[model samples]
Target: MIRVEHLCKRFGDLMVLKDINAEIRRGQVISIIGPSGTGKSTFLRCLNLLDQPSGGRIEIDGEDILAPKANVPALRRRMGTVFQSFNLFSHLTVLENLTIGPIRLLGKPPAQAATTGLELLRMVGLAEKAHSLPDEISGGQKQRVAIARCLSMEPEIILIDEPISALDPTMVSEVLAVIRRLARQGMTMAIVTHEMEFARDVSTRVFYLDEGLIYEEGPPERIFDHPQRQRDRDFIGKVRSLSYHVTTADYDPYALVGKIEGFCEKHLIPHRIAHAAQLLAEEVLGVLLTPLAPPRAVPTGQIVASSALAGTASTGPPLTVKVTASPAPSGPTHPDIELVLAFSEKQRSLEPRLDGAGPPGNPLETANLPDDFALNLIRHYAADIGYERVGERNRLRMRVQSIAGREAVAPIPLVRQCGAGLGGGHELDSATDGDPTEPDRFGRLARRTPATGMTPHQRLSS
Candidate 1:
């Protein structure tokens, strides 16, 4: 019933809404979502003329409401707004709050207004509190009353702004339940909220606001599952990642482990899961890939061998470890952690790779081992592991799983002597030749030496 075209809103020198265009169809629930300060609330206010536009046109029912002679108040009567703060009159009783709008604006008789108010109150499951004052009720109940009050006016459409932002976690669901019921009952609404799952469930159309405009708009499935824009995908997926580089055999394993732990804690991952991630980093970098690192030179100017494992040479390029954490596709209760190890060698380029050949098989099988402890321990903590060749680099990906409630896997005994096979024989020195550096907000390590030019893939055969 409402259509906006090239709508713009400005306050003094700052422009908030720029050339915004959207439509709210009858019985359609449209949800506006985006980062803060993106003008989500400002857009809602402009629709009801609570915030006047600096330019552009808004047409309600084919009538240009922005016209000077158009009846703004009369037009607004057809639209109701519910604010985040539950703007209920303190002096009025619950029943009075619901009835006053209809009585004063709609010109309804007191008894008729009260009867309608009581029905709306019942719809929101707050009829028993009809006589209670706003201050006497809980935050959730207050918001429900506010919604019922908005509905008592019998408006054609409603605008709700961050309806549950101020409520406690326990109270959020109650207010959302009321709104869900409204959506089911065919209430045309434009809601600006941060509740992603709720918006995905209830909205007929989702609007992603960014850069002061409707950056993307689509059905819930398309918006949440397969957003076409990069920003939308990043925001929807909630992806967080960290990367560390290992150039030489002397690279400090403890520093890498500490970084992993800090990343997990920052993301609020479970302790069991965090421990598993640390173990994976230690094994993959310190033990499994130690033979692949370039040799280091000692103070005596003698080059220390990187690996003592037979047939294994220190000819492989530097390795990069990347850790990414994201909410599971099924739900958000448990997040999924991914570990990727990438390194290149000079030999793989000499052989032709078969098309569609999957992963050249798992690297764990090819790495000659003396025992199964390290291999089995790796398998215990990792839910899935695979190897793939991308260009000259060989990448191994592991999906880390939680060890909670499962049989505990003890850490492999450290083997200080260089390569005694791929069985935790690699040494992890406590002294660091390179200084520890801070990672950027995106979790990528900074002030690190770049990896050498791409060579052949030698660690894993394709």
Candidate 2:
């Protein structure tokens, strides 16, 4: 239903998109994934001529959607876009929001438009919220309503830009369910998303983009699971540029599903309950543009002291602290989420001080500075203090501190930051005795050892 040929877009000196080409078959979903700033959204916009491309062509049903004689508005009415931020009119009622497109553009009678609006609301599971206003509903609900508004026009193809990126994890399923419903009905779709799993579940084909062009294209299984290109892997790792779409075909159209399934099986990547839980939490927290450096694994029982925690001993659960990972499942995805409820963002930036940024102004004033480096204002600081480091290889151990059981003397959350190390990884071990339970601890795949089973780090200590 949609075709993009050698599409390109540039803003001033920055080239956001380049030489992009793809087709969106009716009733199939296409997702474009890549790292931040690679022009995924720009590509989507240029398809509808929302962002005039510096070059290239877009077609629908064999007609140029971007050509001058094209009925652009009519074409757009066939394509709906859902934004990361719910761009609903705050002043409009839910009913009003969905009806605006049909009544204004389709010139439908208000009563008919309203009836259709209510049906769309029901389609997206927001029929009850129709009388409510944007602010009155949660972000997830608002996005659903936004999608319903888009569907209200009964478009042939849809363009989505991070629609679920702002939703909470649990809420993400609700929105995704609605989208899945749409896909099943055979609507053509082009979506740009960082929701890796969702991209896997629904897209027909996936495109891996980098530096303004599609570096690679394959089934979602390859793009999401075993991406062939390094740039594709890095894009998915750092910030995915995934496009899972398929060319319009009349025959067996489940090509995207096969790719996703194949990749999942090869990687031993199971859709485990734990994986689902992690994805859910991510919706609550948000992902980062760049992965946070692995926290150095100080040996267990080592204490980190922050005066800030001196009084945080409320008889409750662990204070929220955000943990970050590379691949994500679904939800509003900020790289970082407010976490370790007791710890503040200021404390998280405890890298060595800049030459002159000085104390980050507020909260630190009440706590005692690390007396040793307190005077070194220009020196940035990062420490693996209590975490044990193997004598050789830095043998980085990724530290994951779940709010384990609390003791009366539970140590205050101390500050730790990664600095100046590009190639680093940490081991996650089941045994605190310095042995990783699984071979690949936190993505640090075990390196081959000689006949001896022990790592060099262990051998040296022995």
Candidate 3:
């Protein structure tokens, strides 16, 4: 019913919509979504000539609405628009609001317009609110009246721009329910919305706009579940902090490994990074389970103090881990894939001194006894490590870098799972005595060991 070809809309030197082309068929709902200011609303406005385009053609039924001689007003009458705000005449009653457009524009008789207005109000479940003024009704009711007013015109297509954005959260669902009913009744719609789930559920097609271009468009499943572009994945991750968050109290390092593996496989993370991530999770959680692990050391030079009762403590504060997989920041210096692991510990630990002298010593150097196991595992699997104090809690972080293979590339893929790839991991059994129930014991995994597992500082000098 509507065709927009090579459409471009610009304001002054700023271009909003560029070379946009879309077809809105009867009963098909196309949703435009993106970060704010990408021109979703402007594109919707351009469709109905509410905002004149800078270039290109807009057609309805093969007639160019952008033509100088086009009957623009008449064309607009054939399409209804619902704005973000409930744009109802405050002086008009709900019934009158619906009838005025039909009576004024369509020249329908008062009696006929009234009859149709009442029917539309009923369809929107606002029959009882027909006599209420705009301010006299809730935001949702006002929006329903606005929708019915648009329907009273009986347009072939509806353009809704953030229809529920101005409504209260409690009222959003009410308005969405009405829109859903309209979709079910075969009313064609083009919407600009930030309501992700709603758009995914109702849209026949989804358009992701960025920097004045349709970056991606497809069925909801493809757009949401399998975004092929790096920008798309980054945008999705930013919008949805989609990560694996787990708190382990019983110190089941293997259980955490299972969770990490599942998340990586489901998200299609490379096998190498997934294996390294799983290994890292096991190593971190194992330390929490072991009673022999040193008490959180207070930062006081090389001076180390111990809590006597800590030796008898059976359990510790819950260990919380959050892992997020995202595209690395783009630059000449950043890698392609970044896996971040955040470990939050309630107990105190010696802060790694920047001056390079301390009891726990520099994490850059050899780990003292038990600490050696974790530091070794992480050094072998991950590319970088960091530690900081968050409030009273200590947070240990690790970042694994996996670079994409391109013409200009760096050979960096952390610990691939296969027998002879990246970091060939070894068992933690070699790091500790072979007692599975050892008080200070952590867990281990089997993978290729890194060619350089020990840091230079940890190496024995001849």
Report the alpha-carbon TM-score of model 1 versus the true structure.
0.58
State every prediction's TM-score relative to the real structure. 0.58, 0.52, 0.57
Which candidate has the top score in TM-score? 1
TM-score of model number 3: 0.57
Report lDDT (CA) for all predictions. 0.69, 0.56, 0.63
Q: Model 3 over residues 52-127: C-alpha lDDT tens digits? A: 9999888999999999999999999989999989799999999999999989989999999999999999999999
lDDT assessment of candidate 3: 0.63
Q: Which stretches of candidate 2 lie over 4 Å from their true place?
A: 237-462
lDDT: which candidate is best?
A: 1
* Per-residue C-alpha lDDT of model 2 across residues 1-462, encoded as one tens digit per residue: 888889889899887887888877887788888887889988887877788999888888998977789998888777888888979999999999988878888889999999999988988888999999999999889989988988888877888898888888878888888888887787788889888888888888877778888888778888877778646754555421112321111212244334434433444333442232233222111111112221233332222332335576645332322122212222212221112111112222111111111122211111222121221111111122121222321111111122221122222221211101011112211113224344321233233266765543333222
How do all the candidates rank in terms of TM-score, highest first?
1, 3, 2
lDDT of 1: 0.69
How far in Å is the alpha carbon of 101 misplaced in model 1? 1.4
Model 3 clash pairs are 272-416, 424-448, 424-449, 425-447, 425-448, 425-449
Instruction: List the candidate 3 regions with Cα displacement exceeding 4 Å.
Output: 238-462
